[model samples]
Target: MTESAPTPQPDGLDVYVITYDEEGHEERLLPSEVTDAVVERSRDFGINKGSWTIDRIKHGPLIAAESQLRLVNVGSLARAIAGNYYGTALIVDQTPPPIDEDVYDIDRRYDVDVVDDVLVAVVTQRHPAQPAETEAEIAARLARIAAAYGCRIVGVSFALPGGGTPEEMLSHWPEGEEWSERFRAETIETLAGMAHDVKVSIATDDNVTMATLMDGAAAMADYLSATQTGPLDAAGVLNLLRGGHFNLLIGEAESGYLEVKTQMHPISAPGDTGKKAKVELAQDVARFANGDVDAVLVIGYKEAPGGANTIGSLTPVADSILNTAQIHELLDARIVPPVDGLIIEKFVVTATDSVLAIYVPKQPSEMQPYLVHGAIAEGKVEGAFFSIVRRRGEGSITTSAQQIHAYIVAGKRYLRGND
Candidate 1:
């Protein structure tokens, strides 16, 4: 538990991501040699970038960002800040979109669970080449879904960068006034209902073709940065609005490029291929335990068959860890077992003084029923007897000598008592 994540701050913020995208798990679960290597490399990058994120958060008022853009100008600025301030920064992204596509799909995605407690909601609005939905309608839908879940709906907003014509804005934005104003109003309304201080912002670099859009973003960013705590960055600026330090850059850029490449070290086990898998699985178990989750019920391990003397492909243990890591960065305490078909009825888990505790008592009210079996453990049964009143093969009643002696002693005692 001590090694796991620290206690979450109640005052910070709960972020919720809504989208209709689904995470692709096929490559995540099992990868070929090339894909595995890619994963290994990405893991290294994720760790390094994650460290920066932690540092910036711990230090305060620094940007931590990631982007799909090859040359992240905003990331460079954060790096400059860290370089001068003796601080750290986190800038990581799997691709151009720092927010997972599935995480974006509020309609049919589960990644929303990650930000279930978020104090703010940030999204990216792509001014559609053609209009389909209205801003007010979108807001209504968002409110409905959030209220139905009993989750406090703080704000629903998007991060925009500068540059566009008024006609373009009208044609692009659902509301005719301006995208920034419309978004800010909606955000304020949502937050006011939730009884929380809230603000939304947009960002954009000065550009001619997209000047109007950029102006709108800059205006909103300025307002929020002044009145609220949000700031602007090279990325889409959503991360900053989502409570991330406004340092790293997000989104992909065309033409100009600055891609950072790094190598990854493979975790190898000589004559033992299951080591990585085991570590991953254990980490997952540890995280569950840390979160005070009870038992982990595993459907049997999925595996490819092997010959009488060969090892199988894709270790289940490793898969478990990878899956767990995707959900959480750390694990505290959890119960894990290798077997399948495990069930616990209304189990409770608690942690105290760095130790995770689980309690199960053999009370009848809580006991589960079991079918009698032919094989039973010795010493579990108090006694056993068999008798045949009449047998065609001339069988007779049978009892152990010990039982017979006890019966005789009881009969003698009755006789002596003149019963």
Candidate 2:
């Protein structure tokens, strides 16, 4: 079978081919700079004498080291890729050009990295020589990067002295943004109200060796896939609790057993975001309990929340704000049948910020549908109200009467010993 030919590249765009000379010094040569020796090596690699194409230019010395392609011209492919990536970004690091009519280049002060399929932006403080970046500046930078990359910004991680993911995960309180409660980038998400045009994570206050971050991210990725992790547990979760592993969860899509909540609920306690804490807690716990599989509720993570509730970024739930005791209380007061063997634990992300993970175990068939007593509205708890929630994929669905009836029938038959 014949293979498709490589697409032709446009001419005179200053595209170059790089290879090293015998002296071992780096050499970046233009199409016109292709030397006889370099051409010979290209032929060895099966990039024969023909019109050069994008793929050829891209792959010529990209995999040099492992393959020992040791072509000096390809000395630093990453810098090369970064430079030519979407119109000479590498050249003008200082004054980045506009990506398009609307989106532009990110500020040089901040660095963008694709860590474990998640886009992580690190805020290296602006120069003391220059005025510190303004709140508007940070917001504009986030919006630009999000739009330019066509992905959401996973909030900032301030790596300070010593260990521990610090307050607000260090998301807030940048040199100039110290006073604002709402993060600058978050405003961009609020205005756009969507993933595309622009969006940033709900800021979490925290960071990492990044080793732990990668491991935790790998684990979260597995947990997000139903086929991969059928039911959730603490083993994999413990890894995530270490370092700034939560950052790896950025952009992860929610699943049947995985839920990421941005704020703590107001359950006899002052909370950050949710007013209907009781109802929210009841519904969330009951949803997972009633499901066929076990699940977890992660407080401190935000959802981009389009069709699929994508785990957008972190909104740190500090221990001072919410703790295991509060979670235990809410679960006990809200869900019926007691969510047998349910586990509530806390991990300190930073000294100030923490995450609460509520693990709902898969109960026996007799405990088919766990219900939540509510009559709750806008933070008020009325008498004798109940809700039956079940998880279906990434959403909490109402318990179907058919399934409820089936469970009832099964229970009655079991009681009658009519097997």
Backbone steric clashes in candidate 2, count: 13
Q: Lowest summed-lDDT stretch of 10 residues in model 2?
A: 63-72
lDDT (tens digit, per residue) of candidate 2 on 211-252: 222232233233333212233343444345443356555665
**Shift in Å, residue 22, candidate 1:** 51
Go through the candidates in order and give each one's C-alpha lDDT.
0.25, 0.49
- Give per-model CA RMSD: 26.0, 21.8
Query: What does candidate 1's lDDT look like per residue over 1-419, in tens digits?
Result: 36987754222111111111135332211111222123221111121222222112223322222322122222222222222223232222333333443332221101011122121223233332222334444455334223322222344333223332223333443555665677656654443333221222222221111222222333333323432222222122322223321111112111111111111112233432333333333332322222211223121122224322211221122221223232222111112222122222111111211111111111131111111111112423111321111111111122346764786687799799996
User: How many residue pairs clash (N, CA or C atoms closer than 3 angstroms) in each of the candidate models, in the order given?
Assistant: 42, 13
lDDT for residue 188 in candidate 1, whole number 0-100: 47
Task: Please report, as a residue range, the 10-residue window in candidate 1 with the lowest summed lDDT.
Answer: 256-265
lDDT of 1: 0.25
Q: What is the lDDT, from 0 to 100, of the residue 418 in candidate 1? A: 100
Superposed Cα deviation of residue 13, candidate 1 (Å):
11
